[model samples]
Target: MKADGEALVFYENGERVGTVPLAPLSRVFMRGDVTVSSSLLGKLGERGIGVVVLSGRKAVPTMLLGRPHNDAARRVAQYRLSLDPDFCLRFSRAIVEAKLRAQAAFLGERRESEPRSRYLLTLSLKRLSSSITAVDQQATIASLRGVEGAGAAAYFEGFADLLPERLHFCGRNRRPPRDPVNAVLSLGYTLLHAETVLALYGSGPTPSSASIMRSTSHANRWPVTWSSHCGWRSTSMH
Candidate 1:
């Protein structure tokens, strides 16, 4: 990859593959064996275009943030609030409630078309509603997590009925997804995570320091890795 005036040119085995204009791009994601020129990197940085490099396994992600926000006070405030139990509890509860409601709504929408699965969908919806109530009533994060876990299990249990039989979506399996359905789910989650990290960096908040119903250790790793390479600070709530 190299820059030619205002466009980025791609090369493969010394042969020019194509060229892409930089004006329309917000970010660029590259993977596998690829060579990028210093001039292109400089131009990309100058244009404030982020580049994300995914590992060969396509699971790990490294981000190159362009023109990171220089707000020290906001970072400090986020760090302080992350450590507060009250803040974490309230924030996590609201996030879990919203998640459950969304799950219920999805199931409710599917119920209209799949009459045969209405019973299972209704059961999942009832479980999700109970989980939402539990989230509101629970004072501690641990209890709320339990409620959310139960709701997720119920949701996935009925997931197979919502899909066509040919898809073979037995359950929500990930971390080396066993089936095609799991593979797509894993890929979608990876993309969503990358997008979320970009959004957080663009908004001036540290992704490592933010957690909503996610394990602190697991959630902090991505931002830590990204910040280490991108020259950003890594701080966590836990």
Candidate 2:
């Protein structure tokens, strides 16, 4: 299936939803005739799981929506900024340049080593632990940019080759597949990280136990596409 399946769906009994996912899940698509109870729907929405419903032959949608996240408004604001005439012109170019430079750095480090792509995870972990000293690049642009988005974008843009673009903050939709910019925004990675953090945060039993439960529940409730969506597929979706 294509990576971004539109919305998380609920079926009459979620039978179609039960097909085991391929791996590295991303979005949940609900079909078949089923009604999500208020409580269940609310829980799904709170997870910020995008929902897409199909209509009968009548050509009317049964339901379609996105759950409002606490940070949704803030996210929306960032999108507006990304499209700003000045920002798009300046930042987009800046991002492209930064990404190129980062890829160069990553490659240079392994000039005599293995392929640049294979060493990405090692390079990423190294950078993640690298210390950051105080510095100013574009004080004005930094001030205008959203803190989270800016930091995320700058680092990933710079290290485009090393990180998976799935982790980039594309907002609304899944990051474009194989997009140099968004390779870091892979939803699968974020989901694992969140589960781990939640487990630790609970201060309950072993984090792994909670982690396992939550991850499984998450998969069942809103299975990210088990298969990585590389775009374009056959009718069989294999």
Candidate 3:
């Protein structure tokens, strides 16, 4: 692929294939073996367009983030906020609460649509509500994570009820998803995570500064965090 003025020109077997306007594009996803020029990468970075490359069957992703907001002071402040324990705790509580609420709403909708799953959904909803309430009571990040994990466990129970029996989905499992439902959910969550990082980079905050209720991966060490509240509503709903 090559950048031609304001567009990306595609080629195949030494023949021109198609053209896509770079202006309308926010991010680019390239699978295994796809290649592009360094000049195009620079152009994309200049336009705040992130490029994510996925390689191999596992689809391990490597991201070339766009140029972030130029406000150095803003980034500094964000870094400071990330380090503040009180702020992180408060922010994490809010994030977990929003995630649980979204889960509850999704389960409630499932209950309405699938009468046969109402019992399971109702139980999950109640569990989520309790977790939401407990979010305020948590003092440390570890405890908050526990609350979130329990809520997610309950939420997945309801999610399992919505899937077809053929999928044989009991609960959330990943890193080698044993079932179809888990596989799709894992893929959706991975995409959501990429989008979240892009959004954060676009807004000038370092995605690594996203230290609230998230861990640093040993592989790339790109401090990854997902907008799980939005994920439950946008991803799980579909």
TM-score of each: 0.86, 0.27, 0.91
Per-residue accuracy of model 3 over 1-238 as CA lDDT, tens digit each: 8999999999888898999999999999988677799999999999999998877665667888988888888889988987888988888788878878877887888799899999988998899899989999999878988998999899888888888899999997877788887777766766666777788778777666554436524312445344323434334536
Candidate 1 per-residue C-alpha lDDT over 52-128 given as tens digits, one digit per residue, 9 for 90 to 100: 88776636668887776789888899889878888877877777776667677777888887899999988888887
RMSD (Cα, Å) for all candidates, in order, is 6.0, 15.7, 2.2
Residue lDDT tens for model 2, 9-92: 333333444232223322234445545556545544445443445344322222233342345455455446534656443543
Off by over 4 Å in 3: 214-220, 227-237
Best by lDDT: 3
Q: How far out, in Å, is residue 41 in model 2?
A: 5.5
Least accurate 10 contiguous residues by lDDT in model 3: 216-225
lDDT of 3: 0.78
